[model samples]
Target: MKQVLVFLTDGFADWEASYVCAELNKPNSGYQVKTIAVDLEPKTSMGGLRVLPDYDMSTDLALLDIPMLIVPGGTGWSDPINVQAKELIQHCFEREAGVAAICDATTFLGRHGFLEQHNHTSNSLPDLKLGAPNYSGDEHYVEAQAVVDRQLITANGSAAVEFTKLILEKLNVYQGEVLEQWYGIFKNGIISA
Candidate 1:
């Protein structure tokens, strides 16, 4: 199965990547979710959840060539840290793989100039501008639940549901009517009516 990597770090918003990982874990989802951190150790999330990374940044990350990369927002991403994670994201982009980021995680792409010509949305544009030097795509910013520009997907923290929907759609896990129904049921509890 193709793998989807979720970046793990201290202070991560546990809820942001939960839905994506859950859906990807389905038998026929065609992908599996793995977590990566600077080291193969446990990290505590903002919601007090502990997660152990499946891959170590220093050793296994450069060798990982996956299609989808999911990055959840947290305090950690507010700074220009995690060079290894950033490099891995760049590599994934060069491979034309899908990169999804939510909330503060968008700053990672911003800092790396990935959002330069792509439409994106973050928790706060002003915050992102203050956090990243290469954030020069303000005019392309959209005020939506989620935005998908080619292989790059970005959303604000409040748009986790929409973000999950887009990621699933991009991965071809859900499509057309199936995707709409899934969104309606998950977003509005309108499974039937």
Candidate 2:
């Protein structure tokens, strides 16, 4: 089974992570989703929801054989003084894992030299100092949204549902109508061939 690790941090957006997991768990989807945090203890989200991670960052991530690593954006990524969170972002890029981030989480990618010269966006604070080609559109959420650059897959905001579907398509778990249905709901229109 293909495994995906969602890196949870303090104040992480619960919706993004939950939506991604929920979508990936759909019938016939061949993804094993797991949550990881900097530690094994329960970490809280911005909504006061606490989640117990399956593993710690210190674990042998390379050996875990995760093909993808997702990072959900929240106010936590904006803190310039948080070194550990920054380190986790660095680890994801170094591992050559299919990386995805939503909302303010994209800033973590930008700050760590991952987004340089790449096209991306976020729902976090606008007017960021990122060196990349920031594509901040007015849409509250992007549909069927993913920037497939090299080994990275990024989407903006709570569009994690669409992001998950994109990942499934990439993994050959779903395609054609199945993937179209997933995209239709969010894009407000059917995805035609």
Clash counts per candidate, in order, are 0, 2
Q: 87-187, model 2: which lDDT tens digit per residue?
A: 65666667776787776667666656566545555544353344223544324222334565666666777567766666667667768987778667655
The CA lDDT at 179 in model 2 is 75
lDDT of 1 by residue, 2-105 (tens): 88999987889999988889999999999999888877779889999999888876755557668899999887775445656887788788889999999888
Best candidate according to TM-score: 1
Which stretches of candidate 1 lie above 4 Å from their native place? 60-65, 79-81
Candidate 2 residue 38 Cα shift, in angstroms, is 1.0
Each prediction's RMSD to truth: 1.7, 5.1
Q: What is the TM-score of each candidate against the true structure?
A: 0.93, 0.76
